[model samples]
Target: MTRNNYAPYITISREEWAKRSDDPMLHLLNDFETLQGLNEPLTMEEITQIYVPLSRLLNLYVSGAQRLHAATNSFLGSQFLKVPFIIGIAGSVAVGKSTTARVLQRLLSAWPNHPKVDLVTTDGFLYPNKVLEQKGIMNRKGFPESYDIRRLIQFLANVKSAKERVSAPVYSHLEYDILPNELKWIESPDIVIVEGVNVLQVRPRQQQKEPTIFVSDFFDFSIFVDAEMEDLQQWYIDRFKSLRQTAFRNPESYFHRYAHLSDKESEVIATNIWNEINRPNLELNILPTRFRASLILEKGGHHFVQSLKLRRI
Candidate 1:
């Protein structure tokens, strides 16, 4: 197919734009100053200029999903019960994927038709660091093997199947591990947002026997937060420093020792950590998954998404 033929078919009519202009969800996009963890929040003008279109775009996708369900129900017989629509958000570390997930969750939840929306991050699916250490894979924490793929797959399966109650392990940032016996529970919702660095990563089917059930397999829609490599490097460094000062200062924090470093020392540590750990994980495990997302949000150094590219259905 030619490039044009392969492009995403985004249907944004004037009527839709008019409706979105007055959408209440567009209001939530205003109160937040900047993407979360940024030094400052975005201005109202910036929010309007950037996210108004994005909110409308997401609304269109959600509406389309409902129509698709109706069509499927017609084929399967009218006795069908609707299941939650799951959206996956994936990107490299510090590219603002968390912020994107939160924005979409807030906006999607505001929809009167789908107010029961919920969000779950895949960080909770990672194997505890102790487990990774036992496997001698502590240095590969964010790599695909570091995650409990089976547990993650089962969790998504349950969510997609409309199970009465679903639970996910909780990962502790301060402790830098998955908290034992801590879980987040969810009831059926109109929509669910699953966010992570490798949510869109693809793996080969096992022995070509059964369909692969990688995390992306359960998504009805997916988003990738994208930015220039240099910009992401800087953003990672900035967030790392902020965390070192704040979260790392906690006596029980896994990274507490780094909190007392001098500014110059901290910068060096941040740069090394980014280059050796975060950058490689992004390149080897996360960046390759961008093409698999339903939409790609490209950001500028200012942290505002400058452009959005949606995949062809």
Candidate 2:
């Protein structure tokens, strides 16, 4: 996603992209906190350069979709369920996709009922740890196979159809597993932001196989957050170390074993985990899906997005 496109995008510099927003109320975002997530240094400046214009663009898209849906219903002399505008945001581990989702959810929700915004992460749809252990894929947790693809597809379908009450499985980072009998209930919202590493992925089948549906198939727009391989590795290690002192220190946390480790030991373990699991998943699975996204946010040093590549077609 990072500059790895096929000449189909209109590359915009960070300065120029920031200029796209002429809102007099642009100063409101200066105090809004998008600088969230572990080890993610998202300054207010980054928001103005990236998300402000992006959110403005999304507002227009949502408005246009509403108008088009109303026109269709008027022309047919009947009412149709309003389909929600779904935005899928994808990225590698520790790439700050969650922060992006939260920022957009907050910004979009400010308009009240004009567009009720909801945020959901595909992590909730990942199979339980027990299920993964049974499938012998516990080590491949973030890979595509770790997910309950069918259930994720059904959830997205229900959301798009504006189902009265749709619910998704709840995942617990503390437990590192899907919570038993717990769910995240989602009512019909005007816009839904689905964020996860697997959002933009596409799996090609054997030549004789029948065509099938993909999670991205339901997305009206998709974004892929991209960075160099080394940067991602470092970020993952940093986050892991930070979590050890924080979340992993909780006795109920799944990673409690690493809480007491020295900084050197923590770094070593984190590096090993990245090498054995995360790196392979990124190189083999995640990176290949980058070009499939409608927009690509490419970051350089310091985790700041250097430019944006928006698909022209």
Q: Please, what is the TM-score per model? A: 0.89, 0.93
| lDDT values, one for every candidate | 0.79, 0.87
Leading candidate by TM-score? 2
Off by over 4 Å in 2: 1-6, 22-35, 111-113, 204-211
Model 2: which residue pairs collide?
Answer: none
Worst 10 residues of 2 by lDDT: 22-31
Candidate 1 lDDT, 1-313, residue by residue in tens: 6565555535333234334454454656655645455542455554455456565666777788888889998888885667888989998888877777776677677666678888899999999988999999998888888999889999999988889799999999889899998999989788889999998888664587876768888898888888899988888778778887789899999999999988788889989988888899988889898888887877777876666666775
How well does candidate 1 score on lDDT at residue 231? 89
Q: Encode model 2's per-residue lDDT on 166-265: one tens digit a residue.
A: 9988889999998888988888788899999988778854683766889999998889999999999999999999998899999999999999999999
Model 2 scores a TM of 0.93
